[model samples]
Target: MSSVTTPRYADVAVGDALPSLDLPPVTRAMLAVYCGASGDHNPVHVDLDFARASGLDDVIAHGMLVMAWTGRVLTGWVPQSAIVSFDTRFLAVTRIGDAITARGEVIEKFVDGERRCVRVAVSAVDQHGETKTSGSAIVALA
Candidate 1:
């Protein structure tokens, strides 16, 4: 097997942009699988009737699922071992049929306890261009 080479500290810049990951449109089936896998079987996510009762027109996707997509954008750019921290805030509900795209950009570069690192601003946006989730991550560079 071949090892993937991560970016070196000296070769990266503060404004570098990571490749974006575009996900297929969200679907009820996807939500069902995610619900079972994540054990977050909130009725609002899988039950349209329950969602309507909760004041929503239809079932929504789990926030964690969108956050996971952002995480995928991060790890797809850099090895998971390079990630020092990651977090996100749910800004809006993701409805079924909404296509999501995960994007990230290096906002700052610094050294933490002798380890070179970059602070990356990350977000997941729906096809409407609304950000459904926003967060940042700290990634170490060799």
Candidate 2:
């Protein structure tokens, strides 16, 4: 487990990497629950038969759910109040039983007027090292 603490502006620097977050495998049961909660009950994400008919090998996890796993990594390391913006793009499909892990690196840091901010390049990859999502975020440090 990573140690979580409030970050100070003066202590942060470029090139630092946030600790990686390894999420549980995306199972059928998990997909069913996410489908109901997110109202994204698309057959491609919850029904294997429909997914196969749609040309997918099996039901896939929601893209937003993978993004949320990445979000968990960021929020785990930094307070939500310090976050300015977070965004991502889906790169590849995450199928059932895939274990996604979130990773990030500090790409830049700057002082905007009186506010100190840091930019991070983030990604979510599966156990096989295939990148499923990629994004960047800017956070203001206190």
Candidate 3:
């Protein structure tokens, strides 16, 4: 696993790619922990019976949990304060036991007032290469 390094604004380019983070598999226990911390006790995400009754193969992961993984790709590289904004859309359900990879690429880099910022196209893709979430973020460079 490669740790994200702070990007130097002067050396950054629009096409630069962020180091991808391969997250651990989504286990049932992991979902439970996330549920406890996030206070989202949705049975669809934690109870297999509820999931099956709801027409799913098994319990799914919380969308926000997956989104947070995408955010980790940025936070690992930059200070939290540098993040100006982030938004994501849930594209697909991430079922239990699925391995997800967080990916990002510098789509645009420019000046915002006196601050240098970079806009990145970000996504969380499963082992099957299907994207579960897609998003973008704006991060100010130090």
- Lowest summed lDDT over 10 consecutive residues: which window, candidate 3? 1-10
**Each model's total of backbone clashes:** 0, 0, 0
TM-score of 1: 0.95
- For candidate 1, lDDT tens digit of each residue in 62-96? 99999999998888878899999999999999998
lDDT per residue (tens digit) for residues 1-142 in model 3:
5554567898889888887899999999999999999999999998989999999888989999999999988897787778999999999999877999999999998898998999999999999999999999999996
**Candidate number with the higher lDDT (1 or 3):** 1
Alpha-carbon TM-score of each model against the true structure = 0.95, 0.91, 0.91
Residue lDDT tens for model 2, 1-142 = 5466668878877888898999999999998899999998788988889999999888889999998888887888788777789999999999878898899888998989887999988899999999999999888888
Cα error, residue 28 of model 2, in Å, equals: 0.6
When summed lDDT is taken over every stretch of 10 residues in candidate 2, the lowest stretch is 1-10
lDDT score, candidate 2 = 0.88
The regions of model 2 sitting more than 4 angstroms off are 1-5
- Model 3 CA lDDT for position 64: 99
